[model samples]
Structure formats: structure tokens, C-alpha cells
Target: MQLPATQAQLSPVAGDASNRRYFRLQLPLRTVIVVDAPPATEKNREFLAVDALLAQSGVRVPEVLAADQERGYLLLEDLGDALLLSRLNGINVDHYYGQALAILRQLAAADTAAVALPEYAAQLLAEELARFPQWFLQRLLGLDLDAGEQAMLAGLDAALIGSALAQPRVLVHRDFHSRNLMCLANDSLAVIDFQDAVLGPVTYDPVSLLRDCYIRWPRARVEQWALGHRDSLHAAGLLPAVDDSTFLHWFDWMGLQRHLKVLGTFARLSLRDGKTAYLADLPLVLEHILEVLQVYAGQDVQLDAFHDWFRQRLQPAIADQSWSGR
Candidate 1:
């Protein structure tokens, strides 16, 4: 199959987002992914930035074979079909996690100078969490957070934000999960969807991988994997802190902040982006949130109360929706 130079003749391939199209192309020397991100609705500038940054960091991301920024066309190296999630059956969870951790280490090691990435600052965290009120609570759950409830949430937001800003900062793969990791040839992994990469706590990406909203793993097992990752980062001297337990605290706190952001993102995707597939993953995300809240019990009174209320009201409604819709 000859590769089409223009988007007009490429074969239709499976894609996502109501705004863009993707296609597989075959040339004499290579197979590539052609992304048609129409300028009217979508832009590929971030993708370009991410590709360059990952390549500079020695991570195996799809190479940008060619691009037409004006037309929103990108020809990317075609990483094969086996995703890490698909190969998990009966596999050694420890070893597979080792590979994932290794890849993350490389990404975290990326040059901090590459591009300006967002920090999981107090303002950003609270802004993201506010989506919970707008999308999940008001739109999805259809409930008004009365002044009392709102004040309770305000407290939790303040505490969570303070905890987030106190952690060490590093490169965070905003969506580091199984689906975004490609199982490349020779037992390697290639990272994807890193356009939203940011500078944040080390635990950010690990939580995204182990406690992924799309898939659930036992907390005990996930913890074990996370410890191993922490050790790897420590051994490489990539971390500012030296103590394992201290590192774990950073990870857990960062995770709490991320889960809150994800809950809001998933709800926003469903209500605003018309991407309801993410809604199905809300429970798993909330489970992570509750687990963090429970572990960090003494942090903030308001946070605990909001999480408590979340379990009492939001949990039942989301669970019921999932069951009845099924």
C-alpha cells in the first residue's frame, strides 16, 4: 500500500475526538500514522512540542516524519498494536511495572528546559477541582451544593491545594496510563498523549499508571509497584529527597491532587466534550481519591468532610448510574 502524501486519499482509520481524524499509511520503507487535525477545530502545535521534547529526552515516542501545521496534518511513526494492558494476562506484574517505571523515569528525566509545562500549583488544583462542582455535581449528579456543603468543600480544597504545593516537582505525564503506553518491539514501551505534560510532583505519573482510571488494580499490589518505582528513581539519583517513606508521602499527596483533577476531567468530558466513555471510569478514580483521603487523615478538616460527603452522596449516584445504564 502506497502512503498518501495528502490527507484526502488516506484510508479511514479508527479515531477519537469529534474534531479530528487518524489514518494508517503504508509506504515502501515505513508505516505511519497520519493525523488530520483540522485547523478550524483542533491544533497539532502541542503534539509537535511533545514529540520534540520526548525525543530529546531519549524516550521512544512516535517520530514526526512530516507535518503541515497550517493544515493540521502530522505523519507519525507507527508504533505497533500491543498495548501493555493487552499483555498483562498471567504476566509477572512486578516485572511489567519495572518496565513502565523505567519509561517514566526517562520521561521525568527530560530536560526541564524543553518547554514551559504547568505546575500542579494551588490555583490550578483548585480550578481543576472546581469542575467537580460544575460538571459532576451540578450537571451529572444534578444536586445543588448548599452553602453548608460548599463551605465544607472550600475547606477540603484549601487543604488539598496546600498539600500539593508542598511536594517536590518533576516532569509529569498528565495522562500516563496503560492505554497511552505502547508495547513496542523488544520489550520496550513508548509514551503517548503527552502534549499536556507538566512539571509537578513525582507521584503524579505513577498514580496515573498504577491507579489508572481506566483499569483498577488491588491497592496492595499497586503500592508494591509504586515502591519499586520510587526505589528506581532514588537509585538513579533523580529525586531531591533521600528517604523512601518521605518519597511515598510525596507520591500519595500528588496522587490525591491528580485524582481530584481526573474526577473533574472525566465529568467535564462527558458533559462538555460529549465524551461519555470517560464517565464509566469515574468510580475507579473516586476509589483512588478515597484511599488517599483515608491515608492522609490528619491533613485538613474540610477535605475530609467533602470526601465523606462525596462517598455518601456522589458515590451512590454514580454507582447506580453505572449499574442501571449497564
Candidate 2:
């Protein structure tokens, strides 16, 4: 049934990375969030699936009260007044992350047998990296990878894929950064934007957390948090007999792949979607790519070339954008 006009007043909550609008609706009896997903781009099935999966795993995502997939509307439980980003301004970062990591551990422990989601396979990873040629090189940079450079990059990408696939796979919350975590009442953390959850390397979400484009942590602090998380996973029986250094390898490599993809994704989100806010953060994402390339310098040569190209092409854009403040 349609909510009576007299019963609720709906206003914009905030826009997201996708083409959906979220509204904070005040009903006579309670407050709820209404997700207004248009039909053209987003399907409602993924949200339903993710909501069920996270709820079953004991993560505190918004509770679904009512949904109309055909109409692209959902009424969700109110998670209340704190996003991790907002809380970061004054509250203790270590304490907030402790709560977030506890939730991540629960997500990683979810039973994969029941919800066998997609994995980040070698082919998919390569295709994602290939966007550097298509979007970053051709469209954004207006340059081409020379023939020998192209072949070398292809080989290097293969090695990176081998390393990525070698890591143990688990449920990854794909975008498990601070912005998506809300601090609810009673010190609880509520997860959001999790429709893209999939099965992937255990390190994928860690990189998303530590190397987040929206907000960054110092390398030492991020590494400490990551090591602590590895221990948390070990204690939970989710990870096998992996040492911290080996796990850090998985974290770094996964970060390289993720940063590469984010570079393209942020560029696309700005140029294609008419959302210019993400353009400001592209430099940090590219820097992350270069940083991880240094970490893998001995294992790969093509990454060095990729790093060089990024420096030549994107560094200019960064400077120009900084000057313009656009």
C-alpha cells in the first residue's frame, strides 16, 4: 500500500555513486529511508540479496521494512546519526575502526555455500585493468601505449593476476570504506552501499578500508590496523595458517588492482555521471597505484612502465585540477 501523504514527508537524504536518490522520510509513527532507484541502471535484486546476506551474517545493515522492486522503492530501518566519516572529525579513529573491523570479520565469515557470489577471476581483473588503456590512456590522457610497452604490460598484468588469484578467496564487501559505515545508537555500526558484495580475495576489503580514496590513513597506522584484522580473522577461524608478512603481500597486491580500477572508476564517475566531486580524489588514487607498484618492483617490470605513464599523464591533471580547484 502507498504510504499516506499525510503520514510522511520525504526529503533528500544524499546522492550516491550510482543514479539512485535516497530520501529521509518522516512518518507519523517512525522515520525511514526510501531508496529511489530508477529503472534504467540499477536493479533491485542485488540490494535484496545483499541485505539478506549481511543480516544472516549478523552485520548491522539497515533493516528492510518494505520493498517494491518493480517500482524501485524500499523503506529501510533508520541507522541514526553517525557515518564513520563524520565521526572521524572528533572521535577516536582507533575505536571507530575497531567496531568497523568487527563487522568486516563477520562478513568474511558468512557461509559461502548458500550464497556463492561471483569471484574476481583473472579474466575479470585483467579486463578491469585494461580500462587504463581505454579510458585513462586513450580518452583521458589522449595517448597510446607503444607496441613493446603494450606487450610488456600484458605480461606484467598476467603475473599480478597470478598473485591475486593465489590469495584465499572469501566474501568481500567490495566497497567497505569509512563512508559506507554509519555509527548508530549504542555504539553499533551499520553498513550501507553493500549491493556489490561478491566472493573475492580476503585482502580486497582491507585495501578498500585502508587505502580509501575519500579519506586516507597514514601508512603505518593502516598497516597496524590491517595486521590487527588479520589476527582477528585468524582467531575467528576464517583464515588458514597465514603469517602477517604473507597477508600483507595479499593486501598490497589487491590494493594495486583496486587502485587501478578506482582510477578509471572515479574518472568515469566524474566525466560520465556529471558528478565532479570524485575528481578531487583521483590524485590520491593514482598515488596509491604508484606506491604499490614500488612494493612490487622486483616481481613486475610492466607495473613500472604503468607507474611511469600514470605519472606523466595524471600528474598533469592533478596539478591542473588543483590550480583550478575543480
Candidate 3:
């Protein structure tokens, strides 16, 4: 309940997708972050829990300096404003991404048996997939799924869920992307926005990192980085021996499940929450989905059917946007 001091200079920081707002405290000796997460809506306790879990696993997370549980306020160590997103470029992406990827590997292998968190199970993953149709297709685009398309979607959902639950379970930073990673002064990446962390597929975090909604990398480049990560996991003894092709397949499909969920989520954020900036990013996400469908659809009849429907139905909607030429 106690603050860092009686008073301190404060300034607003850029916001994220959550209801929580942040402020930077300019103190005499040290700067810190103050979070205003509404108790009714935001899970401050979950954030605290996950923060501790991440820290224990040697992943850099903002240290909680002060917290008021009833008031939904928290003061945390300042990890600075240098997001890995801003620092990424052709010249520095390798270094920045290497640091960020190492943090992700640490997070995935983090001990979660003692923590009480939701499992990213089949039902949950399917519910996220349904968001695509419910919010994006029906709500945002005012489109309906026909019986055939619905059947295809159902099959696709089953395939996705089966793939997800079949993977080695670990603590997944449900939204592991450049935006949520802070590049520290020491060049290490500090994770934030981790309240939604879950016991889920090992490939989930890497997929978010590689096929990010906010940034696009060449397919070949992404594959090389991903395979290198698998090598890291194997060397660390976190992942069992597996063929490269199989691991890459898991990473690709995991990306599909995530992008499908993101499409619906961004639409809902725009239409319902009036956060229209997210709409600008939907095209990139759509393209990610389309790109993945190209590689995997031939292997599954359901995926092929859904891919055809999306190409014929959804692609046109996105084509109107300047960013989507496909």
C-alpha cells in the first residue's frame, strides 16, 4: 500500500492492449514504473504471480517494488522504454532477436508445477479459434459461414487443438512478441504483459516471436532462426531429440492457431473497444495466416478446404487494405 515516496515526478507512457495504464516515476536516485490496473478487470495478482515465476526461472521481469492489491496499483522496477521492436533492423535484428529468443527459451522451460495457472488446452485453444469467426467474420465483416465452410472450420479446429495439446507442455507467454519485450540497458530482453501466461505448447512462444503480427521477416530467415532455437533447446536439454522437419511443423501450426485468435481479437478491439489502431495490423496477421496455409494445407484436407475458403472469401476483404496485396 506504500508508494516509493510521498510524491515523485510522473509522466504517462504509451499504452498497450490491456486496460492497465502505466506511468514512469522520475525519482532522485532511481526511476520506476507504476501500473494502474483496475481490480475489476485486470488480474494484478496473476501478474505478480507470473512475474515471480519468471524471475525465479532467470528470465528478466520487472521486479515489483510496491503493490496495493485492493487498489490494483503496482510499482515496479523500470526496465526502460527500449522495446526490442524499435531496435530491430537488418543490422541489429540478429543480436536483438538472439537476446529475446534466449529469454523466450528460459520462459518456456520455466518451472510451472508450483504455480496455479490455466492450461492452454484443447477447449481453450478452440475457443480462441472460434473468436475468428465470432468477432472477425460475423461481427466485423458481417459475413456468415456456410455449412460446408463451417464443417471445414470444425475440422481445422480439431487439427489445431490436437497439434497444440500433443506438444510438450510448458509455461507459455501467451503473447510473446517484440512489442511485449523490453530491451534493457544491458541488452537483455525483459518480458512484460505476462499475466496471461499458461501451461501450453512449447512451440507457442517461438511462433509468436518468429511470425510476429507487428513485424514481418522473410520465410527463409525465420526458418533458420527457428531451427537454431530448436538447437538451443536441445543443447539445454529442455527439448527431447526430434527431427527438424517435425519441430518446424509444430512451430508453423502453432502460428496458425495464434494468428486465427489474433484476427478475431484485433477485430473485437477495434469494433467493441474503439481501439482502431489494431485494425491497421490485421492485414499483416491475415497475410501470416495465408502464408502458413500455403505450406500446410496440402497435407490436410480440412486445412485445404479452409485455405480455399479463406482465399476465396476472406482474402478479398483484406485486399482492400493497402498493406495486403494478396
What lDDT does the true structure give each of the candidates? Answer: 0.75, 0.79, 0.88
Where does model 2 exceed 4 Å of error? 89-91, 312-326
- Alpha-carbon RMSD of each model: 3.0, 2.4, 2.0
* Tens digit of per-residue lDDT, candidate 2, span 96-202: 88888888898888886766477888888898888766765566656666886678668767867877899888888888988899887787788998887778888
**Deviation from native of the Cα of residue 249 in model 2, angstroms:** 1.4
Candidate topping TM-score? 3
* Cα lDDT of model 1 by residue, 250-273, tens digit: 667667767877777777778788
- Show model 1 residue runs off by greater than 4 Å: 1-9, 16-18, 39-43, 242-245, 297-300, 322-326
Deviating ranges (above 4 Å) for candidate 3? 1-6, 320-326
Clashes counted in candidate 3 amount to 0
Best candidate per lDDT, number?
A: 3
Candidate 2 residue 200 C-alpha distance from true site, Å? 0.6
What lDDT score is found at residue 259 in candidate 2? 78
**TM-score for each model:** 0.88, 0.91, 0.94
